[model samples]
Target: MKNMSLVIGLIAGMLFGGGLAYSGMADPARVRGFLDIFGHWDPTLAFVMFGALLPMAGAWQIQKLMKRPFADVQFSLPDTKKIDRKLVIGAILFGAGWGISGLCPGPGFAGIALNPAPALTFVAALLLGMVAHKFST
Candidate 1:
C-alpha cells in the first residue's frame, strides 16, 4: 500500500510538472506576461487556468461519491470555511510574491528543471519564508 501510494505520488508530481512545463507556466517571463494586465498582457495562461478547473471540478464530484480515497483512509480535505485576517494577509503576500517573482510554490519548484539559477534563488527564499512563518507562528 505504501509503495503504491509512493508510486501514485511520483506519477502525479511528474504529470503536474509536465503540465506546468508544457503550458509555459514554468517560465517566469511567461507568467509575468500573463500577470501584466495593461502592458503587453498575455491571455494564454487564462486557458491553462480554465483547463485546470475542468479536472478539479470533476475530481470534487468524484470525491463526493467516494467514502475514502483509493490510497488513503480518508479524504484529508480542508475543513475550514471561515475567512479571517490571516487568510487575507496570506493571499496578499502570495499575490505580491507572485507578481514580483512570477513564481509561486509549484512553479518555483518546477522552474528548477527549466532554469536552475533563478529557480534555486526563488526556492531558497520560499524555504526561508516557510521557516520564518513556522517560527513566528
Candidate 2:
C-alpha cells in the first residue's frame, strides 16, 4: 500500500512537472516576463494561474464535502482567518524573492531536470530558508 501510494505520488509529481514545463512556468524568462507589469509584460501566466485555480477550487469544494480524505491520515487544514504581521512579512519576502528570481518552489524543483546548476542552488537556498524558519519559530 505504501509503495502504491509512492507510485501514485510519483505519477502526480511527473504530471505537475510536465504541466509546469508545458505551460512555460519552468522558464525563468517567461515567469519574469509575467511579473514585469510595466515593461515587456506577458499576460500568459495569468491563464496558467486560472487553469490551475479551476482544479484547485473544485478540490476545495470536494474537500469540504468529504468527512475524511481517501488517505487514512488526519486532515490538517489551515484555521487562520486574520492576516497578521508574520503573514504580511512572509508575503513580502516571498514576493520579493519571486520578483527577483522568477523561480518559486514548484518551478525551481521542476527546473532541476532542465538545468541542474541554478536549480540546485535555488533548492539549497530554499532548504536553508526552511531551516532558518524552523530555528526562528
Candidate of highest TM-score: 1
- Indicate the worst ten consecutive residues by lDDT in candidate 2: 67-76
What does candidate 2 score on TM? 0.91
- Write one digit per residue (lDDT tens) for candidate 2, span 1-137: 55766876789899999999988899888989999899999999999998889899999999999886565355569887899999999999988888888899999998889988888898898899999999998
> Which residue runs does candidate 1 get wrong by more than 4 Å?
none
lDDT of each: 0.92, 0.88
lDDT of 1 by residue, 19-124 (tens): 9998898888988999999899999989999999999999999999999988878878889988999999999999999999999988999988889999999999
